[model samples]
Target: MKTIDQTQQEIVEEFSMFSDWMDKYEYIIDMGKNLEQLPDDFKKDEFLIPGCQSRVWLVPEFRDDKVFFKTDSDAIITKGIACLIVRIFNGRTKEEISKSKLFFIEKIGLVQNLSPTRANGLASMVDKIYRYVK
Candidate 1:
């Protein structure tokens, strides 16, 4: 997986190459397609995230000083968004993660496009991750 800075830069650069919003949307959907599928059991209520329109569940685990996460969502796009967060935060120490800013979502131009509920869900998910880091 790429580092947060690398992923952010890559997404920004990629979007910069697009001539239109249609192309950008296509790229985002493609990115969603590349996310790893979550297991059926991980979608259970114990892991469920409450704010999303789609069902989202996230489980955090720590190993060898690194944080690892498992997540699933009923919506494909949301799942991909969760995957992006996992890629950014996983394998980092709690302090490192807490101190870092998640600017990649903005770099990918997601904040402006997502619905209010979805955007709130994203924020909730990030808050959950930070809570674990603390």
Candidate 2:
């Protein structure tokens, strides 16, 4: 299996191919479209991410000392962003996730392109993912 850093690097490379923010945004929406849907049972109020302009549900599972994430979002771009995070962090150890830095976010220019509300929502998503390990 690829390491989280390797996956992140791959994502960065993928995003780097796009010359404009519009293409990047479209790709993000596509990525979100492909993310596995979270189950209805897990989409409770408790699972909802706070501070998001759109509803996002993230659930974590610990199996065989590895962490896995399942996520869904109401907003297309946000869902795609969440999917990117889940792709990187899923199957990693809690220690790896807790210690890792998400340099890809800035490298891909995702934060700068995002509206402030969306950016805050992204932060909240990351925070919630970290909370899952705690």
lDDT of 2 by residue, 1-134 (tens): 88778999999999999989999999999998988788899999987888787888888888999998889988888899888998999999988888888778888997653344653477877877777777
Highest lDDT model number: 2
Once fitted onto the true fold, the runs of candidate 2 whose alpha carbons sit more than 4 angstroms away are 113-119
What does each candidate score in C-alpha RMSD?
Answer: 2.5, 2.0
Range of the 10 consecutive residues with the lowest summed lDDT in candidate 2? 111-120
Off by over 4 Å in 1: 1-3, 113-120
Name the candidate that leads on TM-score: 2
Deviation of model 1 at 97, angstroms: 0.6
What is the clash count of model 1? 0
lDDT tens digits by residue: candidate 1, 1-134? 66667766766786789878778777756667776677886767877877777777889888999898987777777777777777778788898888888776776677753344654477778888888889
